[model samples]
Target: SLTKTSGTSSRSTSQLGRHFHHRTPGNFLDPEVRAFLEENTEVISSGNLTPEIRLRLLTPRCRFWKERADLWPFADPFWAIYWPGGQALSRYILDNPNIVRMGSVLDLGSGCGATAIAAVMSGASHVLANDIDPIAGMAMVINCELNNVNPFPIAIKNITDTKLDKWDLIVLGDMFYDEHLADCLHHWLGKCIKMYGTKVLIGDPGRPQFTGHSIHRQLHKVIEYSLPEPTRRENNGLTSSIVWSYQP
Candidate 1:
């Protein structure tokens, strides 16, 4: 029942099928995926980010358990839940539309495409939402369509894997979860700055990787927010977030 991509193994295909119900190369335009998104997520006005625009997002019932790879399709729906970091960035973009006006924007780790969609709404000339997970990419597309934004593309891979020379602005949201990733981001973003003069912005909810010694050292805080609460009780206490300008 699983369909295979060009280089993917049979096992990987089976797992992807389980997530997209056997639709190989499933994209945001897939009718099945659109229906699934409609059933799994709720379309609502962003409570804290940009209350003016409605987005399709996950609620508490989605069970976003990020550690369980086996439950990747259902339980670990990171793309569904609107993290505090994303909320902060989305709000910042909306409130300061001029920041992205007429610019080319890239939203790395673009969960549900909130920031990318916000960038489009903010009058960016071009927007790309990139995520490591294929499901997240599809989710971004679906969210963009739900928000009535068009021409926004989703890339399912690491930002470093792509050619970033053409991009004018880079936005990262809640991506500083792991040490290795933070390290990689630090080096890659530094190169992006020196080589391309790309303006970088980051949104985080005080993730461990965004510590005082890590990415935080290079970030200048721009704005703070009381974002929407996570569904999980343990993650509930952390309601504050910050938007930072990356001086890489």
Candidate 2:
């Protein structure tokens, strides 16, 4: 079972309500995702409800992967919210199959293991999926199995941890929004890439922090994504996205 964090009064209690209230273009959760949640209903309802639980319960039901069936069993809501780029990157890798053949890959901030699974599907020799969120790690393990890929080793540790190993390719998905995270990831990614001859492949939806990286490939696939209606945040509509890959 997943652990839950304590919630403060400031947090809203409108998740189920928000899920049903919105009727935007990409509002409904994916059917397969919904099925996965329903299958795991017992686990989700077993513990004290918290933000993490709510997020996990909703993750497998989000419609961010309307364009890609390969991303089934979605892992994290924060990452799923920008899955267009992940699908685009996966498509790009599939098209250019040689880039991933037998390469050792590391998925940093691998929320839900979509990118890592995609890498393995595209021919990566080995993959290491790492995330700071324990639930996210569990999701990755489960999702990989669901996708028929061998469950790669998962580390529930931050990218900036003192004990870190190198890989031939580092795949980063939707982790560039926060300035601090982007900065720390950039530094560590550079070190890993340089030391291991690794290629850094990133999938981002044009967030501000994605500006300074040296881009090798930019895919122009515009995928429509539905935002979770309950968040009540800005940008809850359809948006265009891109997949940017680079070698540092």
Candidate 3:
């Protein structure tokens, strides 16, 4: 006869033990998301945005990874809001060459690490890629590897807690969209530049708050590119790339 197991014995034998277990959904990738990924995989691998801009349908995967919330990264599809801006910023920085030299640089709201990769390529001694989304952090790691750049990942809850290591430059790309975020970021940026002597560079496509800021220099301007019908959202077709610099 088999030995009878007590309730305590059964509970102790189970993996859950005394704790309760909740079942969550697996695989967040939907059909649309998968299709978008498949379409842009090649373009992302190539690191070329010209064709993408012309096509206007290159959906970038920049979505936040919910499962890895601890990492705090931004998650969106590729070619989403920031990818184009990031590419434009990189191109402008490459063309100028004087703005980003060998120095400590930080890419705030790094997203998929496009600007950070550009910074590394532009000869920054060290690049810190920061984001509050774990998915974006993962993408940053992948993108950095693709571009042959090793970026330091910093998950920050707020810009106030950003490390004050006397960085030479801080790049903000497509971050000034909302009033609240823009205001908070602007305040932090002022502190970063005025107190730390860090050169603040911002890349925006004529967002509301972007216009409000007092810029020291407008370094470069890129023509607005139209997005494909499927991917076109608000301000999709009409957008101008502007690189503004501030020194405090």
Candidate 4:
């Protein structure tokens, strides 16, 4: 039942393999992108969350240049860093393996691939790391290789429109950033649960879109984690995060 009936997934994964040059590490995606990451990032095993995985994340010294300014605001450079919501979600899944074990997981808005990596490490049968940004997908691929985990499939497109009924679970970390996106996910995910009984887990550090409205009432707080020093710094001093089981 975890099988992807959507034909788009196959093509999306294929697109990730296109134009792959000689690899610096892992499957070659883009030589220039890989070079940028290699020069700017270091492989980190963030034991604060999932000690079993590693990621190639940006260094504090890495400069954000004018060339990439176009990507700002929309395709945020924030993907280069792990946020508080993702850190807590990853840790929860790792600690509670029965939640995702042998399940099909979709990590939506999967910045830095932290949630997807945790799902794989926790024994998910099928895990898809999805983001509209191809760079994030590439980053996910590299992280998978660094962890020496199973193959990671990525969908380099927006999936918020889809019902995603076939997936056993959908894990969203720090997704409620704006009202429009929040509305879309609230509708889409609510339908998924009603139609196919898809389970949803949301990790949030109290964004307005999540906590500022009635949507907060629908969520059942499952667990909470006090973010590590680094995560707090990246996330505007959010001291802690809560993992909520979305009961829409």
Question: Against the hidden true structure, what lDDT does model 4 obtain?
Answer: 0.73
Model 4 — TM-score against the truth? Answer: 0.82
Alpha-carbon runs more than 4 Å astray in model 4 = 1-28, 65-74
Q: What lDDT is reached at residue 123 by model 1?
A: 98
Candidate maximizing lDDT: 4
What is the overall TM-score of model 3 with all chains considered together? Answer: 0.63
Backbone clashes in model 2, listed as residue pairs: none
The clash count for each model shown is: 0, 0, 21, 0
CA-only RMSD, every prediction: 5.7, 12.3, 13.3, 7.8
**Residue 222 Cα positional deviation in candidate 4, in Å, after optimal superposition:** 0.3
**Candidate 3 residue lDDT tens string, 27-133:** 22234333433344333333343222211222334332222322211122332234445555666666655677778888877766777777767777777777654
Q: Is candidate 1 or candidate 3 better by TM-score?
A: 1
- Per-residue lDDT tens digits of candidate 1, residues 1-248? 11111122222234644667555443557776677667756777745556766667665444322333453343245666677788788889999999999999989888778899899999999998887666676777666667788848777666685665667989988777767677788888888998889999988878665674466777898998875543123344676888999894
- The lowest-lDDT stretch of 10 consecutive residues in candidate 4 is 1-10
lDDT of 2 by residue, 1-248 (tens): 11111111121234542342232313223444345444543222112111122113333344432324323333223432324445445555656657778888887777656667777888989888877644455556556555677778777666576755767777776666656666677777767766776677776656555655333223223333333333212233325445554644
The CA lDDT of each predicted structure is 0.72, 0.52, 0.52, 0.73
Q: Candidate 2: where is the Cα deviation over 4 Å?
A: 1-82, 212-235
Error of 3 at 19 (Å): 17
Query: In angstroms, how far off is 193's CA in candidate 4?
Result: 0.3
lDDT, candidate 4, 22-121, per-residue tens: 2333333776777766766677776346556677776555554323443232234456767667888999998888899999998988878889988988
